[model samples]
Structure formats: structure tokens, C-alpha cells
Target: MWVTSSTDKVLTPSAIALGNFDGIHRGHQKVLQPILQASAVIGCPASARKVIRDSQCPYATVVTFNPHPQEFFTGQSKQLLTPLPEKVKLLEQLGVEQLVLLPFDRELAALSPQQFVEEILMRQLQATRISVGEDFRFGHKRAGTAEDLRAIAAKFGVEVVITSLQTCQGNESEQPTLRISSSAIRQALAEGDIDRANRMLGRAYTLMGTVVKGQQLGKTIGFPTANLQLPPTKLLPRYGVYCVKVFLEGEGENIITQSSIKGVMNIGCRPTVAGNTPTVEVHLLDWAGNLYGKTLTASLEKFLRPEQKFPSIDALKAQIAFDCDLARKILERST
Candidate 1:
């Protein structure tokens, strides 16, 4: 897939999905559906499927911003659920042909609703169609609504598709349907509701890091671990114990060495050991070897318990033993 900046040239007659798409959750997929279908039909042999006419056929494109806009406006770095590289991978998997990353700088932020549509969409991209959620907003101060986009783009003979917000049950039954969104996913992660978050994401929420040498605290207690040093801007799930799957991967993070290694992960400061710095460490069940400097991909599966202080090192060791047993049972049942 092609990744472009605002200044870069885009394919003409573009069918664009416009959004931040931070997590590329199911809701975002709904907005992208129309363009994806068009791209698919346009790419295949005409004999296989009905082909759209060249005048109507379009490049499936996504327009999103970098720096999160929030991070740009607030001048504070924000934790990211899907960083740029991950976003590119996900969009490519969904068949997006082009991704335009509008740098969220002061100049772009100053555009009004009229200029954004006429300058960015019509002039720069020459978009033939635009897709956005009903709740979507844009332009300076978020002054442009989805309806506004429809009205403005109509003058240029561009079709606008506005999708309703996608929602899912909050529980098994008798609960409200919550809208699936990036913010909602963040809330789920903050509460350690990994299962719900993954459901919304349509895939495992993977955390990647390099294994670093630690003090061997877990090894001292017969629970040897591989310490992971994560990117500072990654959005971490709540500090706690979790049932997880760890995958060994190549340095570039594209090659998987195995299916997965079941494990229990701990994320927090080691209160019992008098450690104040927060850490993420995993103990691969029934496995032991040097892992220093290796890269790992951890999939948070189930939340077992929140981080807490223990009375003694012996108490902590006992609790860890129990956690391992529970995690094994959970992983087994899940498989």
C-alpha cells in the first residue's frame, strides 16, 4: 500500500475513507467497506466480476492524520493503540490501496470547513467519493460535520457516504449496545478488559518489545521471566496479571518463529521486591532459555487480577504459582 503525505500526489478518481482510524476497530471498517469493495472489483479480471467503469472506478484510499491531532494540539505525547507502522499493516490487510497521512501541523489545522473540502479533498486528492461516519467531524475547531461534508462536496459532483455508528452488546444480554471506537477500546484496555477490546479490534491486541536483562527476581523464586522493554508511547493495559500468548519474532517484527508460547504476564511495579519502576515481564510456561535482546510479541488474553502488594516474598511466590495454574487452565479451555 502507498503511504502519502498532504503534499504527495494521490491517484485521481479516489474513493476515500476519512477518519483518524486510530485503532482501525470494527467501526472504522464499516466506514471503509464501500471503498474496499470498489477497490476489489476494480483490481480483479472483468470476466470474474462486474467491473466499474473507469469514470466511476476509484482507488480505495484512507485519509488520516499523524501526531493524533490531540497530541499536536495538547503538546503532550499520547499513548497509541496502533502506531503508524501497525496502522499501515492493518489498512493493507483490509485492501486499502493508498493511505494519506496529513501531518497534523499548524498550517493544516488552520483550514476552515470550506477550504478543507475544496483544497484538500477536491484539489489535492481529486476524490470522486468520500466516506465517513455520521459522527465524523473535521476542519478548524471540528466545525465540519458529516452533513456539511455532503453539502460542500456536492458542488464538485463528489458522492459522500455517511455510515451509522457501529455498536455491539455491552454484555451477554440485557445490557446497552456500546459504540465500537478507538476511545472505547482505550477504555477497555485501561480496565484490563482485553477480551472485549480484542473483539472490537477484530484481532489480538499485540504488544511488541525487546527482551532486556533484568535482576532475575522471578528466577530467584523459580518463575524465571523475560523482561520486555516497550515503546514509551504504547498504550499499556492496566497494571495486572494476565493470561497471555507470547510469540518469538525476528528483529524487524515481521517473521514469527512459532505458533505461540502460552504464558503469564505481569505488568506493574514489583511492590514485594521494593521496586518502584513499572515493568512488563512474562514467564513462558514449560520453557526456559536465554531471551536477552530477543524481540517478543505478547497478546493479552484474559485479565486474572490487578497488581497488589504482598506481605512477604514467600507470599508473592505462592500467589505466582496459583496464577500460573489458573492461566494454564484458562489457556487450555480457550484453545
Candidate 2:
């Protein structure tokens, strides 16, 4: 989909969806939709279809930043609901023709609202239309507003579309409408509310990582697991055991498996073993294989239980067995 962090070169005339888009949740999707419709993207992202020169045919583009503006400004490492790589894939799936991961650094952050629109939107991106949610803020010291965007873009004959915040129901139809947002999804995950978070995400939340060596404690206990080494910036759900759908992937995220394998994943420190640092490990149900050095994407399907220290290895093993059984039931029924 032509993902670039280039500050140089003007691309084709584009309709850009601008946001942090951490989780690419439903609300973010709303901002992206009008651009897709307005531009009339000619073909799939995989095809790299060039935009037609006619004034009405602008390619769909998404301009977001890395390290998150909040993280950059606060100097605090923040966990992301969808890391940059995952966010790119999701945007491509939504048929974005281009993705500008504008390097969010001191220089870029220093630009005033006027300079941002002139240099970023009008010059480099050549944006014919710009889309953002109502709450979007931009430029130095967060000085830009949706109205400001409209006023500036209008000066260059660029169209600005502001989308309203989207609210949605929880997994259960009877539940009250909940505001769709990255923070809300993070809160849901923190509260162990997987279903509500997934409902807001419009799909199962996935954790992508490479399988690395662990203490071999699970192996010794007969529940050998592939320990996942996830991105430091990735937001993990509450430390607990979960029913997961596991997929083996090749580099660049091409799926290697014919179908998802059901699994039980544990994301926590093993207090019973005197472990202190948090870790993620998954035991693929009814499967036997070495996943060392391979990449795996595990989708959280159901929350099994909160993590707690057990009395002994036997106790932990017994509980894992039950968790595995329950995961199989959930996976089978969902299938």
C-alpha cells in the first residue's frame, strides 16, 4: 500500500484520513470511510493502482504518526492497542492506497498549524481532501482544531471532512451503547472485558510476536508452551489465561497455516515459580511442534481466568488442563 515516512516528494493527489488511529477502532473507521468513498479507490492496495488524473479521482491515503504524539511529548513509553505494523495492515485492508507514517519528532511537532497544512497536507501529500474525527487536534502544542483544519485546507482548495465520534453496543445486544475508542478498548482489556473490547475493535484482538525460548517450566510440567516475545509497545490484555486462536506466519505476515489452531495463552509472571517479569506463552491445544524462532499471531477469543499463584506444580498443571479443555469447547462452538 506504499507505506512511507518520507518527508520528501509529493505523491499523487490524495484524499487523506488523518489520525493517531491507535487501535483503528470503529470510530477511526468512520473517518476513513468518507475518504474511501470520496476518492473512489480504483483497485485493491496490493495492486498499487495509480490515481486517475481527473480532478475527482484521488487515491486514499492515511497519515498517522509513530511513537504516538502523546508518547513523544510525554517521554513515557506507552503501550499501543495496535502497533504500527498491525495498524498498517489494517489500513491496507480498508483499501488505503497510501500510508504516511509521518515521523513524529521534534521538528515535525514544532510546526505550527499553518505550517503543517502548507508543508504536510498541501505540499508533500498534495491532499485534495482531508478527513479527521471531530476531536482531532494537531500541530505545535496541540493548537489545531477541526474548524482550523477546514479553514486552512479551504485556502488551498482542499476539502475537509470531519466525522463525529462513533458509539456502539457491547457484544450483547442488550448492553448500552459504549463509545468506540482506543482508550475504551484498552480499559476493556485492562478490566478483562475481552468481548466488549473485541466488539469495539470489530474483530478479535491479536497479539503478534516471535516465539522465543523460555525457562522450559511448561515443558517440565507437561504443558509445553511457545513463549511469545511481543513488541514492547504492544498493549497486553489483563494478565490472565485466555482462549486464543493461533496462526503461524511467515515474515511479512503471510499465513503459513491452513487454519487457526486453538490454544490457551497465559500473559503474566509465574508467581508460583518466583518469576517477576511479565511474559506471554501459549500452549496450542492438541498440537505438538517446535515453534522456536517462528512468528505467531494469537487472537484473544475468551478470557479464561485471572492469573494467580498456585500451591505447587501439580496444582498449576491441573488448572491448565481444565483451561485447555474449556478453550477447546469455546473454539469448537465458535467455529
Per-candidate Cα lDDT values, in order, are 0.86, 0.87
TM-score per candidate, chains pooled: 0.88, 0.91
Model 1 alpha-carbon drift over 4 Å, by segment: 9-13, 43-57, 172-174, 251-255
lDDT of 2 by residue, 1-335 (tens): 77778857435678899998889888998999988986664443333345235455777888888768888889999999888778877888898878888889999999999999999889888888899999999999999999999999999988899999898875555457888889989999998889989989988999999999999899998999999998888999999999999999764444477599999999999898999999999999888876888889999999999999999889988999999999999999999
List ranges where model 2 is wrong by over 4 Å.
41-56, 171-175, 251-255
Candidate 1 lDDT score at position 290? 68
TM-score of 1: 0.88
Steric clashes per prediction: 0, 0
Q: For model 1, what is the C-alpha lDDT against the true structure? A: 0.86
